[model samples]
Target: MIEILNPTLLTRAAGTGALVADILHTLKGRSTAGTNLLDIDRWAKAMITEAGALSCYVDYAPSFGRGPFGHYICTAVNDAVLHGRPRDYALADGDLLTLDLAVSKGGVAADAAVSFLVGDGEHPESVAMINATERALAAGIAAAKPGARIGDLSHAIGTVLSEAGYAVNTQFGGHGIGSTMHQDPHVANTGRPGRGYELRPGLLLALEPWVMADTAELVTDADGWTLRSATGCRTAHSEHTIAITADGADILTLPKHMRP
Candidate 1:
């Protein structure tokens, strides 16, 4: 369902957005070698509780996933891109990891994802993958504005990925997000402009641009969760929740220090 936030709820959305951003920044800082995936989940749970927010993913269940997610955060590492279920694994130096989170506070919800290298390994391939996703995410956000169709945003993102020489996967892409986590208006990573849903004030959308280095296919892990690249290529994902306002599109999930 698509939702338009009222003035008061939009204000709350700001708070929710800031909280999600801060928590993610904290996680990135605290993560290091030997850190367990579950540790990050617990940290997210604690911070969320302290902020009086509810995790949207803990009980998330869609046909594509195994069942209830039952996790505080999605910890996708290396080849793992989506539906990463935390387990007993210690992070090693230079491990690429992605953290996707969604939380609701004061009746409004915000969702975001970030991918980064774990340790001091300067793997050019991994570094490029992460940078490309971030660049694509920026392009997608730049294309989002009042009256712009969903296709515009998709096209902007796809252009970056295609130019970067990576294949786009549609199994999962961006989507509408509001009072709940996922919403209507599935925004594909690749599409032509001037099509799909039209933008309007008060609408919230989570625009994520993700890509695998050399493949568009996905394989599910044996654990009933975690989607990996079919060719075992490195992956990257970046996202931000944006609110459609009369002024323009206001990005909600930005790191406190990243004002740009």
Candidate 2:
């Protein structure tokens, strides 16, 4: 379902987006060598509860996943990329970690993700992968404007990834998000430009660009939720939720402290 939020609803969406961003920022700060994945989930749950918001992950049971997600945040480390379910694992130095989060507040939902290195170390490949996703996400956002087609955004994103020498995966990508966590108007990471649904004011989209180091293929872990690279190469993912507006796309998931 494609959802357009009114001014008031857009304000609420901003609030939810900020909340999601803040939580992710906090989680990233807390994640370090020896940090347990479960601890990150606990921190997210507490923050969400304290903000009087609802988690879009817990109790989430989708066909692509096992039963309920049963986690507050997605902690994807190293080889793990999408739908990473928190487990009894501790982070290690130089481990690439991706934190994806979505939450609802005041009846609106916002989703975002960030990938970073856990500890101080020079993992050039991992750093490059993370930077690629971030750049692709920025490119996608730049292509989002009123009257712009979804394909334009996808193409912009794909261009960045492909130029960086990373293979694009279409199995899972961004999507429309509103009152619910996931919605219609699927946004692939790669697509032809000048196609797909045209953008309009008030439309909300979560554009995520993710890639594996060596392969586009993915393998589901035994947990049934964590998706890893087929070649066990490091991966990275970056995402942001933006609201379509007259001027352009307004990034909703940017934390207040980081905003100018």
Candidate 3:
């Protein structure tokens, strides 16, 4: 479903976006070398409850995943990339961790994700992969405008990933989000420009650019939710929820501490 948020609802969306961003930032800060993925999930639940927000994931049952995600946040580590279900694994030094989160406040929802290293180990390959995704995400956001097409954003993101020498996977990518975690107008990481839906004011999009170091293929783990690189290569993901406006795009999911 493609939703164009009214002004009031857009305001609510900004709040939800801030909440999701703050939660992810907090979780990333708390995720140390010995922190367990399950503990991170518990922390997310507590924070969401305290903020009086509803989780868009915990009870989520989608076609690609098993019923009832049963986790407050996605804890993708190293080789894992998307829809990573929180489990009993403890984080290790230099483990590339991706935390994806979505939540609703005041009836509007926002989604975002961030990838970062777990501890004080400087894994050059992991750092480079994470940086590439971040750059791709920035390019995608910069390409968003009122008159732009979805393909423009995708192309911008894809360009960055391809130039960084990483393979792109289109099976699951960014999508329209508004009152729900995932919605219409599937935004692939790569696409031709001047194609797909045209942007309009009030439209909300979650632009995510993710990539695997070596291959574009994905393999689901035994948990039935976590998606890992088919070649066991490390992966990275970056995302932000933005609202289309007359001037340009308003990135709503930046953490309070990160806002200018």
Query: Against the true structure, what is each candidate's TM-score?
Result: 0.98, 0.99, 0.99
Counted clashes in each candidate structure: 1, 0, 0
Which residue runs does candidate 3 get wrong by more than 4 Å? none
Cα lDDT for residue 212, model 1? Answer: 86
The digit string of per-residue lDDT tens for model 2 on 51-168 reads: 9999999989988898999999999999999999999999999999999999999999999999999889779988889999999999999999999999999999999999999999
Best by lDDT: 2
Clashing pairs in 1: 94-119
Ranking by lDDT: 2, 3, 1
Task: Kindly list the per-residue Cα lDDT of model 1 for residues 197-248, writing each as its tens digit.
Answer: 9999999999999888889999999877899999888788998999888767
Clashing pairs in 3: none
TM-score of 1: 0.98
Query: lDDT (CA) for every model shown?
Result: 0.91, 0.95, 0.93
15-125 per-residue lDDT for model 3 (tens digits): 999999999989989999999999999999999999999999888999888778988899999999999999989999989999999998998899999999988998999
